[model samples]
Target: MMDRPVGVIGAGRVGTALGLALVRAGYELVGVNARSEASRQRAADVLPGTPLRDVPTLAKSAGILLLSVTDDAIGSVAAELADGGLLQPGQIVLHVSGACGLAVLAPATEAGAVPLAVHPAMTFPGLPTDADNLAGLAYAVTTRPHDRPLAEELVRDVGGVPVWIADEDRTLYHAALVLGANNLITLLAAAMEALMAAGVPDPGFVLAPLVRASMENALRHGDQALTGPVRRADVGTIEAHLRALRDRAPHLLPAYLDFGLNTARRSRRAALNEAGRLDEVIALLEARSAEARDDIDR
Candidate 1:
């Protein structure tokens, strides 16, 4: 009736971070396995008293094994343990891959272990500390029926809110997260570059609050909070921006147009509840995009 000892495979940032977290959360650190001396050193530095072993050695004895290996390495590692005759029935096998679902752990399942993929929806900046990142984070827990509740409980044990994801939606869900997190950072960097090129005064100083406020307002009101030329669909201003961005950050032109079109679509939806010239506004944007295409073909 007691929880099994937790074993962590792969001494990467996520593995090491979660291992230390589990230690504080009262789970016994059974052991960790990694191929590199640096990896072992990292594990020892952060998680003292934890033994270092290879996959079979860790899987043979540890009741719960956390596979924090890279996605490509995941199947091979699990298969190695299965082929080596090291795994046993009913052991908790967990992997931290976001794109892969429970299927990636088929080797572990073949070895009679119950497989779970618990993906933490947060980035590890490879900093010395990742404990704070674990707090208030959401984890997607996917497992076989017999193993799902245990997976959820284990995620809860580590102070993560567990969300169930359909197997088919795993890739799409991760895609959406990447678009929101990574793409946001990419857009911000591009924005800064463009501002500096424009000779904007204290470009960073000017952009910091403006960008933050736009995001903050969007969070509060969703699409209803949209403003600026796109929301108003000011053909003149948008056309001017298109020209300037093409002259400055030509790479961002497509993104600007795509996101602008999406924003206009949202604004059009918002216009349904209020009295605004959203219809005419969209028509003008359509005209501009068409004209830009025609100019390009010329």
Candidate 2:
């Protein structure tokens, strides 16, 4: 079963990279079904000389079908394959959507295909280096009870560890990843822009060590790694910073207050002695919120 030819239904970043990696792992590459010219070109580059065929053709020629389409398109594509009578018994069908589960492949299953979800828990730039990026990363796998072992094996073959996730937990699991990966990118961009606004010549150079060390510490000690005014409950220092933000960078004030409030709450839960200080900080935040409301009303 592991030696069977695998066909990719989409040719975007995940599809191309995974196809290339599977080829490298000794799995037979069964060509691809790309929807667009760009996708066809990508497949040609990654799995060069692999034949380009239609969805049903690709499904017929391969023992495994990987649906690497967009989230919304996944269900439709499954339905299309099922309608075309392409999914054969004992064949495997998987998608790389973190938020989706085996349910999206109901169409495929009804056609006798074994449904599975195999999401790589990492960002894909769709470049040639994507295969290297896959090494040592985790894969979120959602599948039927009996299919778990095969799913884990497939992930291992792709150079990733499989983390079994319940179908119902897929939403929460994907949300956590987005908050950590996507939102972290947004936060970093904001920090870099704010530093540049403050006359820093190179924000990346200035932030590199500080950001890296903080990340390392947080990974090691969790909330205990927290520092600065929020951790110490220094009301005056926080107030001063809030004032500076309002004057010099008003756009950043809302985010600052929101993070400060969340930090204060976390600190109270982590340390009993800090409750009083945290209460004071919360009061200050509430006051500021009231002032903002009043200003908006005016």
Candidate 3:
């Protein structure tokens, strides 16, 4: 597989980053198929000297074809390549969708091509250092048992550690990533807004150390790291927070209530809080949520 050139079907952020990594790893990027101007420009900028070709041309020329398109578009793209008689026997076809499995590449499989799902469990922000982010990160790989060696080798070639994820578990695995990475951003943005509303000049600077410590603690100790008013059963502090959010950031009230209730439940489960006190916190959050809904209805 290393001897064969690799072709990228979609030159988006993830695609371009992966292509660049492979090139740096000494694999020849034979061609790229980028539809949008932005994607084309990204390919030209990152993968200099690589020809921008059409899908069929890429499929025909390269021995390994990477369909780094969106999760929803993988099947159609694979079908297109298969129907065009472009995917050849023994050719390798792979996708970078964390949510999708080998099913999306069934068309390519039917065309006698090897199908692999290699999802890098890292963000690619399309920066010059995006390729460096691939080093030591996990790649959720799903492929046939017979193709495991090739899949692992390919992941290692791009500086990723291959973690075998069953096809049936791909969606669930991806969901966990979204809940951790994507939702962390949403929660941080909300926190920063609330801090700014409270007259903090530099919300990020104020929260950075605290947030970093909290995350590190959570990662290291899991539920044992639960703290704050919810865990301590500081009902007065909880009520004050609800009142402050309701008065100053009305839109944040619902989320605040939800997170508070979840934190209380986690505390209760971890035995970090007295059962009765945690129940009081839960009740208070539920009541605030009900009141918010009533306001919305009115």
Q: What is the C-alpha lDDT of each candidate?
A: 0.79, 0.86, 0.90
Best by lDDT: 3
Q: For each predicted model, how many residue pairs clash, with residues at least 3 apart or on different chains?
A: 0, 0, 0
Reference-based TM-score, model 2: 0.94
**Regions of model 1 farther than 4 Å from truth:** 36-49, 200-204, 269-298
Better of 1 and 2 by TM-score: 2
Ranking, lDDT, top scorer first: 3, 2, 1
- Candidate 2 lDDT tens digits, 166-239: 99999999999998889888888888888888899899999999989998998899889888888788889999
Query: Which candidate achieves the best TM-score against the true structure?
Result: 3
lDDT of 2: 0.86
Name the better of 1 and 2 by lDDT. Answer: 2
Candidate 2, poorest ten consecutive residues by summed lDDT: 288-297
